[model samples]
Target: MAAVELHVDNRLLDDFEAIRPKLNGHEIGRRSSPVSDDVTVLTMEMVTAPSHARTMEVTLRRVDDQLRVGEIHYWDEHGIFIVPEVPFREVAG
Candidate 1:
């Protein structure tokens, strides 16, 4: 799959980079897969200290020059599913 261009102004892009160190070394749990002609899904697995792991799924949609993050999901050892909280939307961007 082709690499998608991300905008420097995107909030999620910054958030992901900012947390990179805390994650230790991240893993690409799933490669980018096409969900539609304009959208693709990618999953990253992160390991927290001591032994906990978190899987984050990010759905990207092509919008002009940027691959906008349309959805996000987080899962951990407790079987708890968490998502980024947005004020007015059901999905995280």
Candidate 2:
């Protein structure tokens, strides 16, 4: 797959960091990188409970001059920290 060519700002990282503490689940493995054609993916394995584990993928696409978060997929449940069908704008440098 062709990797997405988008620049992600540090503030989003900061936002993620800030949001982590408030999350109910603890992240196991996390990855954020370009996937295909103007789409970047954020994947994370989360342990919501002692034995409940789920992996989620969040796809972000470039729209006009902004990068907006797109679809999200998970194992069985809706992904964490995401509003359905809502877009997240990339933080400006």
Candidate 3:
């Protein structure tokens, strides 16, 4: 397989960077940076988000031919903060 470009969606990466600051003091549950295959995982320890007051472990991974989301483990935290999907709508905004 001609290695699939891992970063096919740079917009996703850029949006991720914008929220990294809020993840300071996070406890990375898992992380892996592979160089031989198209699969990679980036985990971060999240402490204070835009609307949360607890720590969290976030895992971002890409493999096979699709993207997936993992459950956010937060104790007493409201929930995860995520950017809206980039799906093309039938009507233009």
Candidate 4:
């Protein structure tokens, strides 16, 4: 598969960083795909154990010329889980 580059702003990265500690696994890799001109979906591959893994997806939307995390999703053995938007905050300039 071909790789697509996802351009994200500093605030989005900062928000992801804030929630990193809460995630169940260590991030192994990440990839992003543009859903539209205003939206992009970032998928992170995580490893919880030597043979166990999970995936997390973060949907980013552009509003007022700034990219903000709109939603988060996680997939595990149980099923897909939708994460709340409360953990993400808009950073001040």
Q: Evaluated with lDDT, which candidate comes out highest?
A: 4
Model 3, residue 17: distance off in Å is 0.3
| Per-residue lDDT over 1-93 for candidate 4, one digit per residue giving the tens place of the 0 to 100 score | 111123344446666665556544444444354443543344333333212224345576767865665654555445544343356688999
Give the alpha-carbon lDDT of every model. Answer: 0.42, 0.41, 0.39, 0.45
Q: Rank the candidates by TM-score, best first.
A: 4, 2, 1, 3
Alpha-carbon RMSD, candidate 1: 12.6
The digit string of per-residue lDDT tens for model 2 on 1-93 reads: 111112234446644554445444444443455443433343333333222224444455656755554644443333343233446899999
- Candidate 4: what lDDT? 0.45
- The per-residue C-alpha lDDT of model 1 at residue 64 equals 77
Tens-digit per-residue lDDT, 3-92, candidate 3:
111221333555456444544443244333354233334444333332332433345555574444443334323444444235686987
**Model 1 Cα lDDT, one tens digit per residue, 1-93:** 112222122335445564444443453443333443333333333332223324445455657764555654455557566544457857867
In candidate 1, what residue range of length 10 has the lowest lDDT sum? Answer: 1-10
- Model 3 residue runs over 4 Å out of place are 1-11, 26-40, 47-93
TM-score-better candidate, 3 vs 4: 4
- Give candidates' CA RMSD values in order: 12.6, 14.1, 14.2, 12.5
Model 3, backbone clash pairs (residues 3+ apart or across chains), number: 3
lDDT score of residue 71 within candidate 3: 39
